[model samples]
Target: MKLVTLAIICVLMLNSCKNKSQEEPQNQVKVEKIEYASFGKEIVASDAIAAKSMASHYKTMKTGDSIDSKMVAKVNNVCQAKGCWMRLDLDDGNEVMVKFKDYGFFVPKDITGKEVIINGKAFVKEVSVDEQRHYAEDAGKSAEEIAKIIEPKRTYSFEADGVLVVQ
Candidate 1:
């Protein structure tokens, strides 16, 4: 009787182990292939809000307010001199100025019109005329265009920890 009980327990343990092994594969998550060119800290392209939604968030933000977020948008322009900064179209007429965090990374200068996902802190601020002119120069704007930035402008800004340019 004792021998029979021990054999039953052994059989049950073996069966349970077999079941767990079979279930392991099903429980594993599928990792999709990465198809983006990465810059700065690596980031996955998941859970990023669309440009339209991001625009709405910006609309609700006041100057000095900031939120941590990830968003996808089309590149409207890039710093012509060094790709140090980029402007992303929010699907509306508004564009968000994105700069790398800690001056850590730069994107491709010719990425205009390409889609990208950026992980960052978004904020609204008043851009000084001098800074505006500086950015305009970086963008290779004409002297007349730079000169026209006389007044401070309220702008949507982002400090991106990572950027993924969709291929």
Candidate 2:
């Protein structure tokens, strides 16, 4: 009986190790505070700065394209289901979904409407069928309900390598 107990303990320990190894990798993005240059220069709001930058970079971009740059935008909403994404409200009223490059970053739920800047790549693409289903599941929608929803014509996704939570 003692030998059997020891074997069971060893098995459980091994299983725990395996599960840890299978866990998703951490987000590698870094964050830093923005610096103000001088007192006389107009200190641009974070949303304003991000808007200008995104305009310059994404103006000529089309669907199915991608670009890497620093962007600023206001956090319109965040994912309440998984906290994996934040919806950005661009100055134009167009919204973009933003996600950390990995699972490493986090933002406070109350930060909605706050401006932020992040270094990352913006992807314009259509959601694949499988991807749509996966997202639906993550958003806590039932599979049957998700299947009945219409897919988007296109989507703008941002993958951030680093983020700055600006005021």
- Which candidate number maximizes lDDT? 1
What candidate 1 gets wrong by more than 4 Å, as runs, is 1-34
- Native-referenced Cα lDDT, model 1: 0.95
- Give the TM-score of each candidate: 0.79, 0.56
lDDT, candidate 1, 51-131, per-residue tens? 999999999999999999999999999999889999999988999999999999999998999999999899999999999
Worst 10 residues of 1 by lDDT: 27-36
lDDT of 1 at 19: 99
> Which candidate gets the maximum TM-score versus the true structure?
1
Question: Where is model 2 more than 4 Å wrong at Cα?
Answer: 1-49, 52-56, 128-148
RMSD of 1: 7.5
On the 0 to 100 scale, the lDDT of residue 161 in model 1 is 97
Candidate 2, residue 97: lDDT? 73
Tens-digit lDDT string for candidate 2 (1-167)? 99999999999999999887777355446678665222111234343345645754555678778976667777877666656777787677577778877667665655677777766688776777677666667556786888876665466778866666654
